[model samples]
Target: MDERQAINAGKAALITLAVICLGALGVLVWEYATTKEVTNTAAVAVLLVSGGLFWAFERMFGAEAPRSLLGRELPTGATAAERAERRRAYAVDALALAISGVVLGIGGFMLGDPDAFGSLGLPGGPVTGAVLGFVALFVISFSLSWLVGEADSRAVEKRLARLEAQV
Candidate 1:
């Protein structure tokens, strides 16, 4: 198959893997919450298998093709409404980041507080680790969104260039 087709196939495979991993993780979490014993082996195995599959696919198909999903695509000469829509995309992204940061911050605060879940009998080290983990999640999430937005802007510029060349 051509590179584009291969890349699409790889993306589909990765997406399927992600869904399966998430499902398995959800099951693990549910069992742990209900029974107090972590049934995480299956989830771990799924993650390992998916990671191997992704590595193999990347080796076979090469790097992924550049892609952008900024809500709506704009043409070479965008209308005023389209320009506004583009700005709205960034605004929506900022709103999402703000919301996520708040949620993560709350979680981190609750976990760090010994009184929040006193019955669980979590040790201080684990609580500290969990709090730090949430902080890392907040930072990583915002960084990823920023990187993706930058990539989308570059992709739009390239698309505009191609459209101008055709004129």
Candidate 2:
């Protein structure tokens, strides 16, 4: 892939990863705030540092071949609309990450506040629930990011199909 394409692909990957991390954060925050768990303070700190490391990887990763949802690498010479669409998608991915972050933050807060669950006092035990919820979200996001990356590949395939038909 060319430099521009590589950068774009990296941006997309980074944005997606960020979103997943944010989702995890949301759950952590909610759990902590509601439970008033002190251990969460350390966990959140660890998460923040881990996020920074991930960002660093985005800058250092190898060349990226932009792919579509279908997993086909995009053509080097995509049309204006196609390229724009990809960029737009990347922006959305970034926004998704931001939303996830906020959710996780809220989750953490909820987890921290023991009084927050007052009305809902119908809980058997939130300890296991919180752990399970966070883990599930992180795993789901991890898988989704892997599959969604195929979007780039799919776009590439579509472009190729268009070119082939024109031939």
| Each prediction's number of clashing residue pairs | 0, 39
What does candidate 1's lDDT look like per residue over 1-167, in tens digits?
Answer: 75478768878877887798788788888888999998578787887787888667655543332222444543322467744554555455555665565565557567675443223455674455445545555566546754654454555566557658978
Name the runs in model 1 displaced over 4 angstroms.
48-70, 73-92, 100-141, 148-167
lDDT for residue 18 in candidate 1, whole number 0-100: 79
Report the backbone clash tally of model 2. 39
- Compared with the true structure, all predictions reach lDDT values of 0.59, 0.57
lDDT of 2 at 40: 64
TM-score of each: 0.44, 0.30
lDDT of 2 by residue, 1-167 (tens): 75567667777777777777786688688887898764666557757876786757643543345644445554434577765655555444544554565466457657795532223444555554444444555556545654554454454556557658978
lDDT of 2: 0.57
